[model samples]
Target: MDVLAVSIFVFFFLLVTILGFAAARWRRADNLDNLDEWGLGGRGFGTFIAWFLIGGDLYTAYTFIAVPATLYAGSVVGFFAVPYTIVVYPIIFLFLPRLWSVSHRHGYVTPADFVQGRYDSKPLALAVAVTGILATMPYIALQLVGIEVVLQVMGIGVDEGSWLVGHLPLFVAFGVLAAYTYSSGLRAPALIAFVKDILIYTVIIVAVIYLPAQLGGWDAIFSAAQGSFDAFNTENADAIAAGEVGAKGSIPPAAAHWAYASLAFGSALALFMYPHSVTGVLSTRSRSVIRRNAALLPAYSFLLGLLALLGFVAIAAGVTVAGDPPNPQLAVPQLFENEFPSWFAGVAFAAIAIGALVPAAIMSIAAANLWTRNIYKAFINQDATPKQEASQAKIVSLVVKFGALVFVLALSKSFAINLQLLGGLWVLQTLPAIVLGLYTRWFHRWALFGGWAVGMGWGTWLAYGVSSPTQAHFGGPLVPFPGTETNVYIGVVALLANLVVTVVLTVVLRAMGVDEGTDQTQESDYRADAGDEGVEEELDLTAPAHG
Candidate 1:
């Protein structure tokens, strides 16, 4: 073990764990007996806290590890992440304020809650809740992947004997995370985000600037990356011919342009649809906070752009893939291990591990809210009280985190990787019902459901048929663009299919006089903001904590 690195890592981790538990009282509510207090931090985070929380939550450790890993494993194509994030803020900026306004006015806790209120269809709300939960399972698992990668690079948890021994440290790390998250709820992540973001920015800024200079310069890095891609092409010619140009330059070739653009656009649309993303938005104090953060969050996208380039930086640093079977996720972490002192390496590792915790906490909370509000309360216990709901959410959040732990450990790492890819595809199917429905209720609720089914089916089928030299079927996100030999993002194709089905079925269903459910929302509600007069009074959390 790298004793110095491990010591520093433990110190920072224990500090964050302390902070996570203490956050329950940071902006302590009188009581924590409702979704508002527990699930959303009383829906009162200001602009400053919201910025760090949302930024930290969305740009997760999985992102930190995966974006560079993709770039390292492939090349230019992985850069779709950069453009996608750059465009996502603008897309969310256009609609999220309205969502924040209406949700606050109606006391909605999850995206599913808004769907149920807007469409007045419990089935549709359940669908949204289920989708959110399903998509989030793998996402939460991938966060653990980020932590595990760090642990492995630190020369710990490499035991090849029992699987339990191999992942014990990871379990211990998440055990602490799950504990504090259960105690503090949204506040845990919101408060811990401050330290996570500061460490991440420091590590990223120092690495990006200092590493390039140490490795010669940007020109050398680019040249080395190109040389590496050339070698990859020569070795994997068969893969390239099978529509998998696994390596390329900083700019995509003409043949791959559609794939790049569609991936970028599809990811942009799906970014805010994730339940965790919505949780972050709803925690803020006002609609203007949502809009201002939209403008400000691009700072993260800029940092992500820098992070993606680290893959190329790895190539220039002569960081070789080192394992029985090479793991590309190690590119950035390994680069640090090779170049930095053990203490700073520990700091970078702590940054990544904490990065994972913030998002995992938020995601588990979001999933739990979905379960409590849309599933348990909606069906299992319709008369559940505020205290009961909060209790159920806390219990469910713990279950979700442990479930994700099982998912990562029981399955192959390859399965975890593929699930992350599919998570976006599956979540994007909700756009018609959630995003577009926010503007116009033209969609028949059943039609939206039908569209969701078709999009999910078609996307999964196409993804199953895609093959590459490394793996058979479901190889990557790009598939053949309809009516052209070129590839496009499967999520976009699925989303387009989803939209088409919804449009066609809406016209038919309306013409045939099928019932369109009542919309519980109003135009004025969509315009409501903090301190709006007609907004419902928040549940009185002043009652003592009740089991």
Candidate 2:
């Protein structure tokens, strides 16, 4: 029976994949071969499409599985995901258009390309590319994590001995995604986001409304959640409040408090800095497309709010997944199967499954762009043509998906999730270099590299010291260097230290007469426009892009 339900879900997912491949043709662009069309869906997504594409890409399938699971674990800190998302818009409003302007003016595809052309530092560009790709793999892995949980709860391979062999369902699932993403490039994922978001928004809205009716109301829901927390007092009490502990790990009070703040603040700041998110922003047609989408996309933030509340709904419905080997990631899926009708539950499953495809596709394209522009062209084959670059990226996209699959199947689910979190720490290290450098080149190229090294090393060591598997791989919050009692988000703590080192070293290096590389970019470059701008546009959309 569950096999039948999963079959229905996959059926719709494949239909969307086919549509995805056809998007380059749909958005008939004159320059399909360039980075604009292939890397960014042609950079002409108006507010309507940009709204769905960016929102779908940002609030992903992992958010579906992970947030409610966090609530189930009795941690108030997990709720921080809600506020952090809301805060991301205003912060992006400040920086993104400026970046779009500069990127558009200079014909920069990856942020690393901008760093290279701006500061004329190959090492700096290499650093950004490496950091972006490594940080992105775990993130891409988490998307598989989300879909795998959905398939598991649906009983796709119920009689299997372990999670690994049981994953035959996701094998077909991700294979379809890889093919479509490879064939269509950015256009595939951008087009499929419309279907994915519709499903996600539908499932979340219906569940938030219907689950309370089943649970007697919001009061019953919170009461059950609170009761569960009280029962876990001896073990999880302190850790829950601070959002400091991972899953159900042991930690001190002060550590958790700092950890919660660090995760929330740093994550908020770093959210838009992600290459995939940047790819979405840079793909828009006009400056207004980016700004309008920024304002309109808060609708998804509201959806995130509703999604967060489902954790309480799961508790109120008295819907405990019965198996002793139950995956905690199944909390939401199990809740839906128990609460919703089979048909609606099937739709909800489609929502989550399609939800996985949106970000996964976008992330893959973004990574491919980075690899093509930064490494493949920079070192391996400097004279590779546009077609050759695109071909190389297509091959790498397959390898990247399989790499994530290996992580998901070979490692514990908990470990995979932790690697994703560590990836967040890794990506955040780019802030001082990529995001900050956009506004000013005051930080010397050498200082930027120095700060990045220190930050990445410190962040990596912090992730290593924290146990990866026990908390399902989202290692506990970072500890202060000298005082392990005070914890923080590795991204925030390391980024701050990175900046401090950069500023101090910039001053010293300047005092000692170090040469700061010349920036080819101008101030007005950050304020460039689309139509009347002094830049050559890449993709002239004669029609919508499709594979």
Per-model TM-score on C-alpha atoms: 0.96, 0.92
Alpha carbon lDDT of each predicted model: 0.89, 0.80
Backbone clash count for every predicted candidate, in the order shown: 0, 22
- Per-residue CA lDDT of model 2 for 284-398, tens digit only, reads 8777778888788888888988898887777767667645554556888999888777777788888898888889989988898899999999999999998888788888888
Once superposed on the true structure, which residue ranges of model 2 sit more than 4 Å away at CA?
158-165, 234-257, 322-326, 467-474, 481-485, 536-547
Query: How well is each residue in 1-547 modelled by candidate 1, as lDDT tens digits?
Result: 7899889899989999999999888777887789998999888777889999999989999899989887787656888888889899888988999898889888899999999999889998999999999999899999998999999888888798877888889989889999999899998999899999999999999999899899898999888988888888888888777765555566788988888899999999998999999999998878888899999999999999999999989888888866757888889999999999999999999999999999999999999999999999999999999999999999999999898898778888888888888999999999899899889988999999999999999999999998865689778888997888999999999999999999999999999999988899998988897778755334223332321
lDDT of 1: 0.89
RMSD of each: 2.5, 3.4
How displaced is residue 173 in candidate 1, in Å?
1.1
Worst 10 residues of 2 by lDDT: 244-253
**TM-score of decoy 2:** 0.92
The worst-scoring run of ten residues by lDDT in candidate 1 lies at 538-547
